[model samples]
Target: MGKKDLLSTEPYKGVRDFYPEDQAFLNYLIATFRGALERWGYVEYNASILEPSEIYKAKGSENEEVVREQTYTFVDRGEREVTLRPEMTPTVARMVAGRRRELGFPLRWYSIPNCFRYERPQRGRLREFWQLNVDIFGSSSLAADAEIIAVSHAIMMALGAKQSDFIIKLGSRMYLDTLMQNLNFDEVQGKKLLILLDRSSKMPAGDFERELGEMGVSLEMLSPKTPPQDVLDVMERLKMMGIENAVFDLGVVRGFDYYTGVVFEIFDTDPKNSRSIFGGGRYDNLLALFDDEKVPAVGAAAGDETLRNFLETRNLMPTYLPPTKVYVALTSESLVKEANKVAETLRQGGVAVSVDFGEKKLSDQIKTATKHKIPYLLVVGENELSSGTFVVRDLVSGEEKSLSRDGLLSFFLNL
Candidate 1:
């Protein structure tokens, strides 16, 4: 028999397979990340996965280029053209525009979304992946930018990340345009240069030179790489309002037309990974493209799949998988509801409790407890019920403690 062709029948590439182990860990990771975001006062929101193709086309955003270049777009049976969202900003913008009048100033919205793009899948890249999108609408000040970056830092720190793990390489749309316009470059030429500049770090110096030369750029212009001193001095004053670590990089054009100013890229500071982790910037022109009032916005979308790999590279996630703090067990089936009642009571005390509903041997119950890493198991049965007392077993320490019905609540609360 001849070798079969892949397209004839095969699983789609660039998707994921979440086995049980992956499911458990992913749940824990999402919980930890969301907990951090919520602490920053960012409310969760979601948008439709399918959006009109023109939504991206209007501002000529990077995603629009990707839509023409890499999106998995198709026409519906009704001939309605739709595309899977490659990013979330435009969808968010559409939602904002619909209710812009009612929405108060400085809206903070976040979403963990599954976005798609059709392209060559590689390590740290996938066609389908989840991202953490942090957006601040109606704020144009540098304080908002600082808060965004700081929250990103906080999330990383909460997830056991360190400063040295990544570097925030900042740039400004105003700075870039001011320099390019100073060189007498028109908007058309400036955009071409930006497309080239976006690859500055990726391509070798000679390749970068040739690529620019092919576009009528010169070696001398590329040599004095960053913006001139006076312009940078002004931006430095502007950047001071942000966190001290934010830097001005001439090479960071952000590859998105919607970014009007204060652009930045986040790169891995560790030598092992030098790629950009994520990028975002202020976009003041996007809403204007919709004929809606210009609403200044800034946000970032971090690829969770990419970040998972980065964290895994650094062994950054917590171990032991957030062990169950409480497990309520019915030593006899007769005490099912009682065990559940005690479990609920303990849970209300801010403890994580699991109830055993299976009719199994007590040994089987203990085995289940040890297997699931439930450190504390609460036992309720006839003798304990009649006496208004309870038995608790600490699986790891092999210690059993008994407490009165009144004391059970305090016992678990203290643990």
Candidate 2:
């Protein structure tokens, strides 16, 4: 070897390379999410993955680690610093503010955007992931909060998940703020307490208590037996709407300081995958960062990674079916044109068809179709072309049917 090759087959350390099977599952999850959101009159929206670096630096809006370390930021050719978005909320807020007067109030928008973060990858946490961000803008009512939660519940149910599959843990930044004030803690102390409480679930029991003690706060103050009235009202409203899984859990501070009111997180109930599937809360002031008038908003983001984990743990993942419903295999090179014609007829009848040239043996072609999991296979030979009829075999079952041109069109149309 004159020169050694230095190329690596691995994807970037923290990101993913979604092969066909992985992409099929991702598409299924996205379709399920889109259907649920659209049923609620939520229109889809998207933004460029690149944004100015300052967007993440907005006060009280993002996690510090996201800005200082996790973000993929670099100076472009023009010497302007750009960053791949670690989240979608700031960009969505910017869009709303840019056309605040033009857009209708109480707008429902949803997007499935890939976000990047430079962090240690674990079971559910990845460096790169796609998240479904659903939000209702320009609504301050607790009903808006409840509707957001309801949409999240709807997505779970749409994916064949039962009510018992997950639990909605409700919290309130406003309630925590009130408690801090009542306890005579200042803003700095309150911020520290919120960060601690947010990490409490992941921290060990003794270490968590010790940190709170060092900060002059006690565990009882954070996890009161009775939840605050607003949190209770939101949970009750969700319950009234037949979402029985909603409950109050005071430990959900939602990491971001911008969450002003009711916050909620959905957790997988299975012990094996016991982690947060996704969560969001009321960020009434996020829009104010752009304009003087604040548009009260509540939204939730569900990640494909965590949701897939939940479905896999519960055995609810959908079976992958190849997009091609029928594969047309040529019996020999002489019949390639005839096979193409047959595939065209099937396509005109609204059937997904793939034509295989006769490079491989006919038996090998059928094996390829079977290996791809295509449900139906049609072999076009000289006799079938001369007779204007073909045999279609169901790959799943060993069932075969002979049909004329019109009959073949009707068969798939009926299916």
Candidate 3:
């Protein structure tokens, strides 16, 4: 094909192509969150991106705007409607309901899955992104709610975030429902009002007030009311667990229709990234869509895009370090065999090694190592091979240390 006919190098709009460095940062984020979740006894689970389109269309799972507009949905070759999962909660609910007869309850499950949405790409909101979802099933107690919230706090801290760096604003759907009932809102009107409140932060105050006026409600009527005891108890428990930043805010109505009880959002304290990092809440009725049986569940998901933005805003993003620990630079083409032996020895000792194979000048080989950010450089030349000793150069510090083969293996292994 001619140049004009060549495909553009750019990724599709609203999605990302993760280059090595980008993937390394994503790995770091997933690793940190995975460690925290596993420590809390949460096991990982995953499912395909394609799920039945009707799952999102279900009344209790997602709202109509998301189902009708945002989802990447189409009829598959099998003549069945399929969707690239826009979120994970419905999929997990389906899985749990499908196996409810065989599974043990109070399940602590987690998943890091990439979700898709057909929306305008913006900071923190992408058309394709990965999310760390942590959920607990078969528990209706407030402790389950508290524990799920605590897991969010723990994951944030694991990423080197301080309590002052973010705040958990708690709310309850039950409390919002009560206020709506007092305002005499019927079910349809109540749904509209909740969605309006969920978008309140993004809309202008005048617009919000005018919309509430249209709904025959006033700003005063929506002002902060006392949260239900379930919300208060979760907040108290989080405080007792040393998560002091969690506070009750009456405005936190999570966008999903599934949330039946206490809901929350973790917001970055820094004004530069001023938005909810992630949020979830108790949804006891979602499983009912599959059958009459209801399974109580509480969970939260942290999006990789939003989490990275939060870390970058606060300068807490971890540095990307290549997995290769040392690069073997050969002095001459004749030394390729010796270089391989040295590389193999290091590999046997659990040290990541890369051999230059005398393809470049020794100095250029060292430059290649530096370019790749490999921490150590080992020059395999005639003298080093004859003496059975290698000089390992620290790429960062410019320090040199001579060691025998065994000593070199021990050094890299210890490092």
Kindly give the number of clashing pairs for every candidate: 0, 0, 0
Worst ten in a row by lDDT for model 1: 229-238
Q: What are the C-alpha RMSDs, in order, of all predicted structures?
A: 5.0, 2.0, 2.0
The regions of model 2 sitting more than 4 angstroms off are: 1-6, 60-65, 203-207
Top candidate on TM-score is 2
lDDT sort, best first:
3, 2, 1
Tens-digit per-residue lDDT, 27-116, candidate 1:
766787689889989899998899888887776655567788888788998898889998888888888888898989899999988899
Between prediction 2 and prediction 3, which has the larger TM-score? 2
Error of 2 at 51 (Å): 0.8
Query: lDDT per model, in order?
Result: 0.76, 0.89, 0.89
Off by over 4 Å in 3: 60-64, 203-207
The estimated TM-scores of all candidates read 0.77, 0.94, 0.94
Error of 2 at 102 (Å): 1.4
Comparing 1 with 2 on TM-score, the higher-scoring candidate is 2
